[model samples]
Target: MNQYLLNGKLTAKPGHQEALAAILFQASKLVATAKGCRLYVIGKDKADSHSVYVTEIWDSKEDHDNSLKVEGVRELITQAMPLLDGPPAKGQELEIIGGTEI
Candidate 1:
């Protein structure tokens, strides 16, 4: 199977996790239902409440590339950026694993 992975963390203002939660929930649903989306997950840092991480995968590189152009995905990121206290650091990755969930 073809796959894609991404990781990012954002620093949000205190008491704003709830707000971020709403956006994340909506974004997550949009992403999870998107064409070729195999998996998508967002996780908050246990040690730092302001930090978050997402891991995602698609059925193929074409599907993955197309996902970047999805309007819902673009809107989600746009809506989320203002909530951050700092620039988000992100990295894209290809699958190379024992095949267990991350």
Candidate 2:
């Protein structure tokens, strides 16, 4: 089966980039042992000080969906909501074909 990949960006309110990055860092830790989790990486947008990007790879689309139910995830989402600049953009979903192993 093809792997599921998601590339998303979250824009934090002014002066909250660090705060938002912290939340996403927490999420990465929480999902480290979750079933089907492959990669959960966080990055900063070079030109956008307020933007944080997340790249995730999972065994399947279902695995990614089920990640939301993992313990502590919902709470983290709630915490992050107030730090956001506005509604988030929909993440880009991709099907993995091949890639260099990290």
To one decimal, what is the Cα RMSD in angstroms of model 2 from the true structure? 1.0
> What TM-score, to 2 decimals, does candidate 1 have?
0.75
Write model 2 residue lDDT over 1-102, tens digit each, in one string.
Answer: 989999999999999999999999999999988999999999997889999999999999999999999999999999999999999899999999998753
State which candidate has the highest TM-score: 2
Q: Give Cα distance to truth, residue 69, candidate 2, Å.
A: 0.4
* CA RMSD per model (angstroms): 2.7, 1.0
Query: Candidate 1's residue-wise lDDT over 1-102, tens digit each?
Result: 636665555667776766776787777787676777877777787788766666667776677677767668788778888887767765567764547753
Question: What are the per-model numbers of colliding residue pairs?
Answer: 0, 0
Cα error, candidate 1, residue 83 (Å): 0.4
For each candidate, the alpha-carbon lDDT, in order, equals: 0.70, 0.95
Alpha carbon deviation, residue 18, candidate 2 (Å): 0.4
